[model samples]
Target: MSFTIAIIGRPNVGKSTLFNRLVGQKLALVDDMPGVTRDRREGEAKLHDLSFTIIDTAGLDEGPKGSLTARMQEQTETAIALADALFFVIDARIGLTPADRAFADFARRADKPVLLLANKSEGKHGELGAMESYALGLGDPIQISAEHGEGMGELYDAVSKLVPPTEDEDEEHEETDEERAARPIRVAIVGRPNAGKSTLINHLLGEERLLTSPEAGTTRDSIAVEIEYKGRGFRIFDTAGLRRRSRIEEKLEKLSVADALRAVRFAEVVVLMMDAQNRFEEQDLRIADLIEREGRALVIAVNKWDLMEAQPGQIAGLRRDADHWLPQVAGAPIVAVSGLMGEGIDRLMQAIVQSYAVWNRRVPTAALNRWFEGAIANNPPPAVSGRRLKLNYITQTKARPPSFVLFCSRADAIPQSYLRYLVNSMRETFELPGTPVRITLREKANPFAHKRKRPN
Candidate 1:
């Protein structure tokens, strides 16, 4: 394993800013609000020639036992334990507060190599704050502005002394044809609280990689794990159960929900798991709608199927309910699976793969326009303000959910119902089901209409 560094500080310090700078991406959500980060987010960081794994941790603070703050502190502690070194950041503008001193003692007691960073040290106040850090007895403070990308050379020098050099492999990232073609499929399992999302992932993994309990909201972070199912590589993200907005009072639970939403946004295929006994609830529909709106490939997994007694017409009823409730994903594949009994897992995986394939499907422009002409001929666009709306042509702009742009004379005049009709028609004609299809209307600019007529 490579050397790992953990960034720890009191609330509102520039830890996240430095983490984002090192990683060269805004992976962690940065906000002026204190305690924005509550979990340990890891990313590969490079400073000039040095490369190591950097962990962005939640602000260190004391809270009541079993509370959300306590859990966040536990996550930070975990990151501290995992790291070979630590970047203890302090807001230079504020100098040092009692909380900063307290956390400084805590970091020193951890017995890891600590790098003192006086962040936001761009002005006179910042310089004074950096000078005050010397009293903490960690080491000489590295005055730097994480936001402005200053003092990186000094920061690099400090890190270089602590961590050993690694052989450069910039070119090794080029993948072979076989390796490139066999990339892991990213799937996120999401559902309401106590819906057995963790149980389902544990069953698929054939081991307890996640902490599962009868208690609701056991998971508070979106955890990703890799597994191979039937020779196919899969990276599945098991997310925290989403409760109603009114029910979520704690700030930490809100962050957890946000993290789960990010996982959904990052995923290619989303498995919307639901308890078979209490299927198609209000929250379930909301989540399904969210998936559709995000334009992600979706698979509905009715979990805990083994618990429910087999009924003659139960399957048909479930199918009808899916179609009735979620018309947006009209033909989305639904599979019945028992995460505990390990039944119907193969079918669920197959459905996920199929949904992903559908999401990535593309239709030829010629065939698309041909179907468009036929669809318009069969049911012409409705007249707007006593003038018939003229649809010039249709062409797919992009794939991954198959977005199309329709050129028309009066684009704004076409009603939403008409667009819905065209989308449904395109879905049916192109054999596209379940995947979200986006249709954009564009008015062909009439150059001659603007020019004044020369004759009479």
Candidate 2:
């Protein structure tokens, strides 16, 4: 069986940062603020030759029921229950607090193998804090700086010891010729300039691997990074910031935008990043609509939230704005994050995984046809050539923005407005928000039902 490790800690302790380090991508958001992560994010991780599943959990906190803090804690608890081992992270620069102690106790009660980590241990200043980690009673501490990538060897050793040898498992998992031909998840990250797209990537890689600048249009080409998640490999494409056509004065900028659009077409999941200050700009909506039109799974992320003054109403307000402006993508999970500060990174990742799950969701043909029948019963297809269009059968042809092919009569005569209605109805009925749904109408020829014509 594949080993599973959970990264647990208090807020701002670099749990998500360490997660990205292990997963080899800036898949998680990092920020200085506490309680930024409010969900459990899972990814495939590898250290040296060791491979395992990694769960990045929200920082633990005590609060009233249904509150964000409480919900985060609950999510962490869920991670604790699911993990085979736990990596309890603490900030070496800040030392431990009562909250950390409380969470340590919680982890102890879970009875799973636990590794204490003193993260951010880059210099002598962090040494004292690393030494102090012994008090947690979780055994010797592994000191490392997730941001600078210091002391990764010790982390690899510690994790290797906790996980059983996978030599035989590896042999069993070696892919045959047919297995190697399987398609991989195609992901593209598109956003406006300086929306933390590169920062987010750097965070995932746990290194300053991407060139980041304050200037707009810094990235000129699409970069592809392949990594594993949940024991499966995924290909993530980071594309250049898309600017409006009117602003494309430079040839290089025009090329970059075209390249970004091409990336969108190739992606199965198109993650659209938005600057928190300009959450739902016309350009943002346009990008989302374009993704939908291309039949790609969509996930919206709000970046650079550290600079914003967030209130209790901020998330609600953003949700309302998304619904009002991008109704086609309604119910799309909008994760608030500060890519620079790393806040809300875990939640963002969880949302990605969830959206991916939905994108790959396939409804049974029987159930789908039943729903189709009900939809047709509720609102019949528009009349064409003085005859009502007959939609006979529907079958899901593909997923990753679930696509269906409908066998019907007079497919060529079907109106675009009616197709839009069907698409909207499917979206609402299937709870597929923020992602595209494709339906192809094909005319069916009757064989047995038709009378034999005079020999033609």
Candidate 3:
């Protein structure tokens, strides 16, 4: 169960600043100009041991309230109603005002737990304004410098107190494998413009929510759509078709590229869609390399397969080309599908689920050590500077793409080639093809051996 917290205040009170602070990222655009944020941006937030959702709302203002402002206010109010707690922020440098009082009354009427924050309280000049926050009748104000990151401990305490602990059943329920598998698999469809990305999504969803045409670059934003396939939930992200950076002249195209990169970062698996006629372009390789660099699971879908006029052994020729050109993602599952005709959709989904499972796999410590020993036995680590390097043990330190740390006698002397050998061996042994594996070599610490002996 996740809780949401809304940051509400007038313009330039550091509401966006505080939202970024709580979320631990600059996800929301922050500028000195008033009314910079027009939309309600949300992010995952963590405070101490608690993790929740944080919403950055547009600055509340007074007017006959135009449609945009009214919509912003409605979004803020919706967040307030849904949130377990709210952070009512005010600029301490400017002190309290009638507008602040008006909003305080609005929060009071809502009957929700409100944490009054006196933001911009970094200097002595803001002391009086911080003291003035008490007049809002929202209880004692927590002095904070959202920009400077002061008083976060108190904020964490306040939020944790407001949101109750998770029930034991809920905690246990999350531990089940079914629960783990039930999480929506984040999948990103990436390719060049007019490469049938939007068409593919529209076909999968059996709707026309996405605008599709022969024109290139029709979709500028990365749009996420949720669908259940065979009773499994999948969150598919349709990203803008990324063109070569040198060719991107328009400002919107630049933004679109950034958005596509962001989508790649957020996705667990990337489905690289390509036109069968124009497959394996330089830009396509660049996109595939980006996915590989991000250590994401990958599945290549050759779209427009129905339109391809092929002779005998054409499909075999294409497979050989893929094997030779994309050796980094060797053995990646490639499905020749016509998104227009909905061919191979089921096989594509199965490949996606399988790739996602491989991406999230965890190798036990004992099994990992055994594999490491076997690998070393098969191909020993090379001797360096007349010294044979001894690799003691290997253990996985992290999992979302499976990272391991190898404790060795001399980590600095280990060459990159040896590391690659170990990684390749692990990939083959664990059947983790087409997925990037990270192996870090570290010198083992020997505390007892380093201590000096005491002579009586």
Question: What TM-score does each of the candidates earn?
Answer: 0.72, 0.56, 0.62
Question: Which stretches of candidate 1 lie above 4 Å from their native place?
Answer: 1-42, 54-180, 453-456
How many backbone clashes does every candidate have?
0, 16, 0
Report the number of the highest-lDDT candidate: 1
lDDT values, one for every candidate: 0.88, 0.80, 0.83
Candidate 2 structure quality by residue, lDDT tens digits, 161-239: 8876455453455677557435456778898877778788767766554456687766655666665655555677777
- Alpha carbon lDDT at 346, candidate 1: 92
What C-alpha lDDT does candidate 2 achieve relative to the native structure? 0.80
Q: C-alpha displacement of 433 in model 1, angstroms?
A: 1.3
Worst 10 residues of 1 by lDDT: 206-215
- In angstroms, give how far residue 357 of model 2 lies from its true place: 2.0
RMSD of 1: 5.6
Candidate 1 local Cα displacement, residue 188, angstroms:
1.8
**Model 3, span 40-86: residue lDDT tens:** 56677877677787877777776555454565576577667777778
Clashing pairs in 3: none
